[model samples]
Target: MSIFKKVSESERNTKATIFVGNIDPKVNEIMLYELFIQFGKIKSLNLPKDRISKTHQGFGFIEFKTEADLKYVVQIMKGIRLYGKLLRVKQAENKSNDTKSVSNKPRTVDIGAKLFIKNLNPLIDEKYLEDTFSTFGEIISTSVDREANGESKGQGFVVFNDFTSSDNAIKNINGKILMNSKVVVTYAYKDDKQKTKHGDKVERLLATNAKKHKMLDSSTQPTKKQKR
Candidate 1:
């Protein structure tokens, strides 16, 4: 018999999920699979993609067979650069904010020059998005949503430096054929005040927690009197 014990498919997915971010656009499913499999058996690997266009969303999730394996990957993979971008690996966010679950989606309140797009072609990537949209004006950024398996989610966002260009893009490109698919483009809604408030709260919370941790660590250290 082989030295390694065989694990069932269900058993492989019982542990923590790792959220990987700042992914290089060029990275693909095969590369990620090969790299992560070295640490442990993966239950599921998802790279969120645009729903319509089906392009990599520059982030993904990897579910391991055990918590130990998941933690090991996060610890060792920190600051590891691949394809010219440093990866950010951490525990996956709980499903509380999942679009389907959130009754009042916060994204609907967003106000900016950014455009929300849907029904993108699977073959299209970020560069293609920029190139195609740049004709209207300078693009601030472009992103395509992808799923865990690195497949396109058929939706994405593009931000322009100014509203004029954004308006032009919406007028000129909305409902246009892109790579054999008709795309829907509209203003991306955002709530800047709420977002900023939330950001400040998070920062304060992290700082407070860090201070508490430091105090606890220092208090637990052995002193000269104890050593004597």
Candidate 2:
């Protein structure tokens, strides 16, 4: 008997979805179905393809008939080697709820309070990124850049309530590794004005350091008053 035949329409309506990333280009939908069906009945599978190449994108989404089945697959398949590449599997985001929540919120913009992060691991989602930087200050927002099909672009932004928090995050979190990927963090400039302001801030910090160094050098010099 076909495994999908046992799943009813109602069960399909409440299907739990999972995102599978780092998929080998050679693996097709048929291969995925054949491999995953052994765990449970699958309601649907979507492997987005490139428009020109028509090859499956390096990621896909799978909807299972039940949450338990989806969890089991995620637990078993995560980090599993397929075609010599480790798979990245996790629960898919509920985009509809996220969109609704964001649309209902009042927008507040703060200049010089956002940090740009680059070279993030594919497994590092928005929640994980936010939690890692939350020790510095209250975060206003966090976002991970993604393609239309939801593959990570390996970069993100963290917006804090104030400039101090953002600066602190850049100083501490930059050059740190998370999930085996070293990230680069810097000020996210929205316009020319912000860029100029950031340049001024850097100049001021350099001037201060130079002045301190000069003072220390002068203090270490020997006095010539004994010759008089």
lDDT of the candidates, in the order given: 0.59, 0.61
Q: TM-score per candidate, in order?
A: 0.40, 0.40
Encode model 2's per-residue lDDT on 4-34: one tens digit a residue: 2423324444337776765665688878888
After TM-score superposition, the amount by which residue 212's alpha carbon in candidate 1 deviates from its true location, in angstroms, is 50
lDDT of 1: 0.59
Candidate 2, pairs of clashing residues: none
Clashes of 2: 0
What clash count goes with each model? 34, 0
Task: After superposing candidate 2 on the true structure, give the runs of residues whose Cα lies further than 4 Å from its correct spot.
Answer: 1-109, 191-228
Best-performing candidate as measured by lDDT:
2
